[model samples]
Target: MFTAESSFTGDFKLVPLKWAERARKSYPLESTSTAKAVNYGMYTPESMWNKCTYVISELLNECLVGSWVFAISPTAADLSTIASWISDILVDSASLVLVVLEWFQVLSAWEKTFGMPVLTRQDSEVTYSIVPAKCYWTVFAHAGASWQAKHVELVTQLREKVAIRKAAAANKQKRPEDDEDDDEVDARLHKARKRPQKNENKMQTILPTEKAKAAQQVEQPEEEEAVDICSDDSDDGYIYSDEDYSE
Candidate 1:
């Protein structure tokens, strides 16, 4: 069960109720504003308030049963404050002023149960409470065993959804990095295939093959000239005989 105070402060926005005239004509309600006021007043009426309480209690019981079933079948529990709040609201309808007030208590209970801090306006005076964690889980375990199979199925589905979402996010994050690596590899391959081969061909062409051959031929003539000059040189002016030259 839950208890909460209503501190929601805001101006009401009037919606033009269609069939306002027809409804008034049939029901003798004085005006649309009167009808609205009467409807609002019903929650505060003692008899009507008890009926509302009963309904809220039933809802809370159902949430507890469902939550218990869900919690025990799986090792994991829903730490979501919303789920806790729903459970609390079901049990504590007597304390809720309006549906909105009920929601606030449920949220507060959830936060408190999960060790989360509550956020409130500086001027607001809202607070909530529920059973502690160990007792809560123990109660859930006791109640949940009967509905274990269904609870397991529900939790499995939820976990699968979470896993799928996480995987999709990981893939989304990795896609760009993969693309960047591919671009770099492609750029390197393209440079290797296109640019380096052309440079190698240009290098081959630039080598001085013709000039080297020409230089070799010119050096051969110089060497022959030096040999002839050496042979002709002598202190005496007389030429050697053919036999002496052969020797």
Candidate 2:
């Protein structure tokens, strides 16, 4: 669950989802306010192991039945039943444990995905017992038994990666260097989340168009008055009559 909590200092931090969300959000242009940066998953070293325990407990019943069936007939354990039984699964840790504990050829594909086992003593037992190192989460995380044997060195690298992811999640929650404003950061995130307006009220900018071309019209012919040759007696060199010249 994406749970939230507050400390005595009145500062609140979110959990589990926080880690995953924060890691993803840390990318460029993908960030929100870091004021509450500590909220990421509470995946501390101790808690990681405990989380694994929870995962084991949930799969405990299915693993037992499936393992036993596999011991008898490898194909007898139905994966559908395993899927229906488990709710949440993380990492391939628990499946590896059963592989190490017994060299039984069982399908751990189910565990490649779920979470926890609780510490409960047998009804007849008088005291609580600590889980053995062999039963530790690290040992389980390394459980990658397949139809074929893994090289002795390959297991070491796989376990290292599991440990690194847990550690990375744990450390990523520490207050980052950015001391950004909480309110502004929240506002920015809220703005980013909102769907863009289909019709923004912004006044459309009308771009200037090319200048219109000069218009063309027919030119009317002007009437040319006839010059009378006989009117040369006038003070002017030529005398014009109102009548126009004939073709």
- Considering every candidate listed, which one attains the maximal lDDT? 1
Single out the weakest 10-residue window by summed lDDT for candidate 2.
Answer: 6-15
Candidate 1 similarity to native, TM-score = 0.23
Candidate 1 pairs with clashing backbones: 60-90, 85-106
What is the per-residue lDDT of model 2 for residues 1-247, given as tens digits with 9 covering 90 to 100? 1112211111112114444354312111112111112211212122121112222232233232122211111122231111111111222222222121111222334442353222222253422111111222333323333211232234445557767988999887745443456667988888876635322422222222211211212244567999667677868676666473552
Name model 1 segments beyond 4 Å from true: 1-150, 153-189, 208-220, 223-247
Q: How many residue pairs clash in each candidate at the backbone level?
A: 2, 17
- How do the residues 1-247 of candidate 1 rate in per-residue lDDT, one tens digit apiece? 3312221111011223466444211212122122232122322222221101211122232222113211111123553333223122111122221221211322243365768645432245432222211123433433543433333344456556767988988877757779999999999999889978899888887677877888889888544434553365787976677788789
Q: What is every candidate's alpha-carbon RMSD to the true fold?
A: 18.9, 19.4
* Candidate lDDT (C-alpha), each: 0.35, 0.29
Name the lDDT value of residue 168 in candidate 2.
Answer: 95
Q: After superposition, how far is residue 195 of candidate 1 from its true place, in Å?
A: 3.6
